[model samples]
Every structure is written in C-alpha cells, then in structure tokens.
Target: MKITKLTNNISLKRQLEGGNEEQLKTVRNVLQDVRENGDEALRKYSEMWDGIKLDDFRVSQEEIEEAVANFDEQLKQDLEEAAANIRYYHEAQKRDGYKLPLANGSWLAQRIIPLDAVGLYVPGGSAAYPSSVLMNVIPAQVAGVERIVITSPAGKDGKLPAAVLVAASILGVNEIYKVGGAQAIAALAYGTETIAPVDKITGPGNIYVALAKREVFGEVAIDMIAGPSEIAVLADDSAYADEVAADLLSQAEHDALACAVLITTSEKLANEVAEEVEKQLRELPREAIARKSIENFGHIYIAESMEQAIEAVNSLAPEHLEVVTENAESDAEKIRHAGAIFVGRYSSEPVGDYFAGTNHVLPTNSTARFASGLNVDDFIKRSNVVYYSEQTWQESAPKIARLARMEGLEGHARAVESRGWTKGDK
Candidate 1:
C-alpha cells in the first residue's frame, strides 16, 4: 500500500460519479424493455448474460425444503444465531410515534406505518453470501414488512445456492425468485405475471444491478446504489500492525475494486502494516483479487497529528471506520462520518459484519456523509397528523388568513373561513 497526502479533487469527482451517460442510457433501456416485454425480455437477458434458460423464475417450496434439508446442523444453527442477534438489535430501532394535545385543543401526532412489501437482491456468480441474506432480510422482518421476497441468479442446473435458499427459509422469505441482474430489479420494480412488485428494494449487487436500481428509483423505492465495499482504519503507534493489516484485507477480499485504507500518525506503523499485508496476502484464497485491490486503491496515509488523521478520515468517509489510537473512544466520537465505527483492537470489522448485533449493509464510496446504513426505520414511514378544534381555529384565524392571502392561496384561507371563525375572534 502506498501513502499519499490528500491533494486531488478531479480524481475524487471521477470516482464519486460512478456510471457515465452511456451506462445510464443502457440501464434505462434495459429497464424499459423489461417493463414493456415482461418475461420474454427476462428470458432473453438471462440467456445472453447468465448463459441459462429457465422454465419458471420463482423458486418453489419443494426447492426451498430441499435446500434447508441439505444444510448441516451446525450451519443451520449458525444462521439461526445470526438471525436472532440481528432481529434483537433492529427491534430496538422500532419506533411508535406519539400524539399530543395542545392547550387550544388541537391534536398533533405521527404514525409509524410499515411498508406493504420489500424485495432483497442477493448476488450469485463467483460466490454466494448467506451472511448478506441475514443482514438485509432480518431488518425488514423486524420493521413488520408484510411481504418479503428474495432474488438471485440460478446456476446452469437452474437451482439457487443451497446456503442462499437456506437463509431465505430461515428468515421466513418464501417468495424466492431465480431471476437476477437488471431483470430481477425490473420484476421487483414493476410487477410481472409471476412476480409481484414490491414497495421497496434493498441489498447489494454487481454493476448491472446497481445501475438497475438507479434507473428505477421513482417507479419503486430502492436503497442506495452501493459501490464496492470499503474499510478505513485510523490507527497510531499504539495499535498492532498485524491487526490493522488483517482488517484491511477483510474488505479487499470483496472485489478487485474494493478499497482498504490506513491513516495514522506513525510512519513506523504504516510501514509495518504494509509488510504485514504482503505476508498475510499469500495465505488468502482470494489473494489475486485482494492483491490487485490493495495495489490499485489501497493506501496508508501518514498524518502529522491525530487531528490531521481525523481530517483525513472525514475526507474519505469510508463505509467502515476502525479507530485504534491511544484514546480510541475519544477519536471515534470526533468522527463525523462513516457507515459504521469500530473502536479498540478487539472491535474488528467482521464482528459487526457477522455478530455484535449491528446492520452490516452500509453505505459505501463516501456516501456515509449523506446516507446511512440500512435499519428497521428504512422499512417504515412516518405520517404527520393534525387536527384543530373550532376554538383553536378561532384563536389562530387572523394569522392563518393573513399568511394564506399573502401567499395568494384563497382556497387555503377559505378552508379555514368555512369553519365560521372571524379574524377578530379572541
């Protein structure tokens, strides 16, 4: 990993913008074709890209039962444990809006309503991520979403991964579909003959799936179009070099484009981490991808002071931030941006990813500054409610009338006027 001072703006814009005009146009065309041609277009794209033909896109109960039976008892127990932890954490996030009565007898309240349906997209190609299934599905279930669906690509044998199916079964997501890519997104966005459209979509995917979510934003609500996973560790001389190296490699294994950064005040620590990364890289199964990611996008910045380290971390706003300094808790509190923060040596990134009862589907590519990680709140909506008694209307009549007329909205003034309240009433 190379260390460079932060001094580039144009390059930052290029990375943040993600897709160009051409890619947007292509994605838009695919979404349109799916909307118009329906299942016919889905079959065509599945053959062209996935190199498979399917008789039915939705996974059946028999398939799910078989997949669940195939899993060993230990694997099944692990999935259940992860799901239980996720559920407990997210259930605490459930909010019930309250109603209040004013002195003038007016009522104001907010009602929390769960969405009707939600869809989750699980990537299938190189490897399957049952862990991702637990992360995305459990939150929606805790939010009390009515209908939940899972979509992933099928293999040449026309079967979804056993682990993916098992996870879906464990989460009570019966509506599993074999379709993937832009087609699965289209099916979720706009209802097909077989698959019912959902109110919102969540989960991660490759470039095409990301582009599809971007294209169908208004037609159906979507979680952010996620970039490659990222992790930024803010450490100092007090931190162990090998521990820092291991956490960075955890994210690099995601893909060739994934980013892992180390920002610290110790030049010595930086050098040690770089050497430790190389030593650990040899033992990883995804060594080639991790090597390329670390080579191209990874870095170790040497800040002159702890304040400068915090400033550097803010500039990056990485998806995951690990603070391991002399005062790690204090440093973590000073951080303004990051999807998730891990403090101290024991709080590794995987702890939150698998256990520790926190959502792992977080914002990436510097989106932490504006967006947030997926939670139970994402599946619920808040509606503001208001009611004014005749006495309350009378008290505020003059001000309401004046403001409504000032805005040239006579209907707004008359709506209150119809209540038979005079401007002079007191």
Candidate 2:
C-alpha cells in the first residue's frame, strides 16, 4: 500500500472493465443464439461453458430437499435468520400508490406495481453465491415480485451448489436454473423453452455476464452494470491501524481490480496502516489476488484535517465507506456519496454484506455518486396514471397544442387538438 498526501483533485474512480471488441462480439452472439434457439442454445452453452448437461434447467423439489438434507443445520438456521433480517430491513422500502385530485374531476396518480418476474444472476457455482441469492431474492420478495428465479453455473458434475439450493429453499425461491454467463442473461431477457422471460434482472457476474446484461438492457430492466468491489475507510488517529488494514483487505480480496483506500488526518496512522496492510496481505488465503489489488490500487492518504479527509472521500464516492473517528456517526452524517457507510469500529463492511440486513449489491466505479444498492424499488415500477375529464381537456387543449407545435411535432399538436376543440372553437 502506498501513502500519499490528500489533494483537491485526488480521486479513486476505477476505469471499469468494459469488455473488449472480441468479448462484446461473443456476448452479442450468445444473446442472439439464446433469443432464437431458446433451450437448445442454453443446453449447448451450459455444456460448453459450465460442463452441465440437463434435460431441463429448472431445479426440482427433490433436488432442493436433497440439498437441504445434505447442508448442516447451523448454516440453514443462519441463512433463515439472515433472510428474516434482510426482509425486515427492506420492508421499509415498499411503496404504495397515490392519487392527487385536480380541478374539474381530473386527477394524476402513480401506481406502485411489482414486476411480474425477475431473474437473479448468482455468479460461480451454486454454493459459491448463496449470500448473493439472499441479497437479491429477499428484496424482490419484499416488493412482492411474483416470480423469482436464480441462475448460476453448475459444477463440473452438473449439480448446483448445495448451499445455494438451501438458501433458495429458505426463501422458498424454487425456480432455480443451471445456466450462466451471457446465455443466462439472454434466457432471462428472452424466454427459452424451459426458462421464462423476466421483467428485470439483478446480481453480479463476470465480464461476459456484465456485457450480456448491458446488451439486453433495453429489452428488459437490469440492475446497474456493476464493476469490481471497493472500500474506502475514513478514519482518524483514534482508529487502530490493524483494524483499518483488515477492513481494507476484506474488499481487496474480492478482485484483482478491487480498490481499498484510507484517508485520515493523522500521518502517523497513514504510515502505520500502510505497513499493516502489507503484513495482513501475507496471511490472506487469496494472497496473490489481494497482493495484486493492494499493490495496484490500495493507498493511504494523509489529510491535513477531518474536513479535507471528508472531501477526499466524497470525491472518491467509494462503494463502501467506513468511518472510524471520535464522532463516527457525526462524520458519517457529513458523507453524501457512499454506497454504504459503516459507522464506528463494530459496524464492519462484511456485516452489511451478509448478516446486517443491508443489501450488498452496490454501485461501484464511482457510480455511488448517483446510483444505489439493490432494494425493493428496483423490482417495482411506478407508473404514472392520468385521468383527464372532459372539462379539463377542454380548458387545457389549446395550451397543450401550442406547446406541442412549438417543438415542431405537428402530429402531436394535431392529436392534442383532435379532442373536440378546433383552432377556432377554443
């Protein structure tokens, strides 16, 4: 980890890995094949990519029960409790429709409706992403989405990970599919014979899955095109260097491109954290991967004051921000641009990632400036509803026509005028 002075122009925005031409071409080819050939394409690609071959993609009840039987009881209890916590947290995000009355019995309204179906793309094999399953599925369930589906790559032996199956079973999400990559995205967007199309898709995936989501975005709604994970710790001298270093390494181990940074007022803390990060990197099981990330993107910035530290953190807009200061809550309140904030020493980043009930799906690559983590809102649509009375239309037709014609949309102007008020009649 490198230590440097914080500057006004300091930024940690990653250049996201948008796929190259070859990868984009492959993504497009896969999306098109799945769109046209349906289940045949899914089967062909599942075998080629995941080495999975099944007559049907859906996971059966028997399979789910077997997975549940095989999984340890303690893990099942933990997942169920985690699901309950997640459900409780997201319940607050549910929205209700509203209508406002206007003059002449006219009214404008908004309808909050859940999507008919949504697909969650859990990366790796099934067992690898049970946490993702919980994170993505619970919110949609909270929003009352009717059909929830899980898509993951099967293991070489053509089986989904048992933990994943158990997690889905805990949530009662039975529509699991043994497919992955761009093809899974395509199958979600355009229905295959075995898989039904969904209105929205969410979850993290590799470059190919990200590309496929990008390509199919217009055909169906999608969560943000996420980049690698990242974390930024805004700590003061009161924070322990070792604890800060450990938190930074948690995100660094996620991907080689992942970023970890510390902006602090104390230069002493900066130097200590820099050394501590190197010491901790050696102990990480994913040492090589974390080493690459820490070497390339990790840093500790020395800020002249807390104000400067907060400013630098805002500029970065990290996916995760941990505040460890004398006034942790006060400092966190001042932060305006973080996907999630961990306050004080106890609220570590992983708490929200798994058990703390906050959604782990977050915007990365500085998109925290505008985007948000997945929530009930992502699975629901707010449709604008309007009911115009005859009297209201008669009173507003001429003005509406004039505004439409100002934009040179003659057809639009005429359409507005055709509601019984001619140019001379009004």
Candidate 3:
C-alpha cells in the first residue's frame, strides 16, 4: 500500500467489467440452446467446459447422506450452529400483508409473497465456499421459498466440492446439480428434464456466469451483478497497524481486482499501516493475488482531520468498512455508505462473512452507494392490493376519471366511469 494525501479531485469509483462481444454471443447461444434442448444442451456444455461427461445432472440423496456422514464432527456442529444463527436472524425479517386505513371502508394493502423457487450458484473450482452455501440457502429458506436449488460445475472427477455438499446437506437443501457456467444459469432460469425453473437466482460466479445472469434477468429475477471484494478502514492512532493491515489483506486476497484502503487523520498511523501491510503481505498464503490487488487498488490516504477522513469514506462507499477510531460506534453513525460496518477492533470483517448473522453477499466495487446485501427481501415479492367501498368509489370516480383524461388515457377514464353511480337493478 502507498500513502497518498487525500485530494479533492480523486474518485474512488471503479467500473464493473462488462463481458466482451464473444462472451456475450456465447452466453446468448448457451441460453437459447438450453432453453430449446434442455438437458441435452446442459450435458454438451458441461462436457466441454467442465471436462466431465454428465450422466446425471442432479446429485442423489445417497451422495448427500454420504457427504453429511463423512463430514468432520466439529465442523458439522459449527455449520449447524451457523445455520441456526442465519435462520434465526433472517426469520425476524419475515413480513406479513398489511392494509393502510382509509375512510368509508376503502383501503390498500401491501402483500409480501415469497417466491416459489430459487437457485443459488456457488462458485467451484480450485477453492470451495461452504460459506456461500450457508449464506444463500438460509435466507431463502427463512423467506419460506418452497423449492431451492443448488448448482455448481463438477470437478474433473465429476463431483462438486465435498464441503459445499456438506453445507447444503446441513441446511437440508434437496436439489443439487453438477453443472456450472452459463448453462447452469439457463437451467435454473428455464427448466431442464431434471431441474425445474426458479423464480429468482442468487449467488456469484465468474464473468460468464455474471453475463448469463444479466441475460436472464427479465425472465427470472437476479440479486445483483456483484463486483470484486472491497474493504475500507477508517482508523486513527488508537488502532493497531498490524490489526488494520490484516483486515485490509483479508479482502485483498479475495481477487486480483480486490480493493483495500485506509483513510486516517494521523500521518504516523498511515505510514505505519503502509509498512505493516507490506510486511504482512510477505507472509500471506495468497501473496501473489493480494500483492497484485494491493499494488493496483490499495492506498493509505492522510486526511487533515477526522471529518475529512469520514468524508472520504462516504465518497468511496466501500463494500466492507471497518471503524477503528477512538469511538468506533460514534464514528459509524456519521457514515452513510457501506455494505456492512465493523465497529471497534474486535468486530472484524470476517465475523460477518461466516459466523455472524449478517449475509456476506454484499455489493462490491462502489455499488454500496445504492445497492444492499442479500437478505430475505431478495427472495420475496410485494403486491399492491386495493379495495374501495361503493360510496368511496362513487365519490372518487369522477375525480379519478378527470385525472386520467388529463393524461389522455381515455380507456382508463372510461373504465372507472363505467362502474355507475348507484347499484340498482330495474
């Protein structure tokens, strides 16, 4: 990390990588083929991309049981406990339809309806993310979604990650598939012989998966187009340089494009943290990736005052923010933009990523300026309900018709006016 004086003209926004023309064409073809050919297209693509022949796309109950049976006892207990925490937290977010009172027995209500089905796409390759499984499945389950599906590309050995399988089993997720890439997205959006279509899709994947999600968005709802992981620390001299460096590196190791930043009022703390980051980076497991990320996106900005530092943080609107000042909670109140805020030294960013009740699927890049983390609200829909008593309608109909006519919507005006002033049969 390099130290930079916080300048008035600098911008922290990073653009999302859009798919190339060839990738877009490939995604379109794959989606269309899957929509038309169903399971056959899925098999062909799986064999080509994942380097494995697909016999059965769905994971069997026997395999689920075996994964659960062979999982580590301590890890099993941890996952169950994590699942309980996630379920308990999300359960409180549940909502019911409620009506707004209106005079003359006329009212409107907002209906909260859960999607019938949802698909969670957990990335698989060299690494495994059982945390993704737990994070995605628990909220949809709490939202009361009836059918939840899991899809990930199989390894060359023709199996998804065992840890992922174990986590899904812990959550009692019934449907698991050995497919990935755009084809898995298509299968989830449009249905195959074995897999059924879902109303929404959640979770992240590679560029191809992201493009596929963007392509199928109107057909089936998608959470958001996630970007690289990011963490911004607002610290002062009270913070430990080593602790701050470790927290910055936590997100930096996620991807070569990940971003880690520090904004502080103390020049001494900024320089100390910069040196500490380099020292810690030398010993990290993913040093290559973290170094590249820190080299490109990491920075330490010295602000003239804490107010200026807080201003820089809100301008950045980072995905994960750590407040390690004299009064962490008090400073956090002044912040307006962040996917998740970690208060105090003990409240590390990883706490929310895995064990904490909060969801880890956060908006990355600078999208935290407007986007939010995944939650129960993502798995449900809201409908507007309207009712009008005869008297209310009669009193309001002419005004409604006159307003519709002002907009030149003759059909709307006529529709309301056709309801007649009185209910009487001669």
Task: Give the poorly placed runs of model 2, Cα more than 4 Å off.
Answer: 125-127, 408-426
lDDT assessment of candidate 1 = 0.88
Q: For residues 15-85, could you state the per-residue lDDT of candidate 2 as single tens digits? A: 65678999999999999999899999999998888876778788889999999998999988999999999
lDDT-based ranking: 3, 2, 1
TM-score, candidate number 2: 0.95
Provide the lowest-lDDT 10-residue window in model 3.
Answer: 417-426
Error of 2 at 166 (Å): 1.0
Give each model's clash number: 0, 1, 0
lDDT of 2 at 202: 95
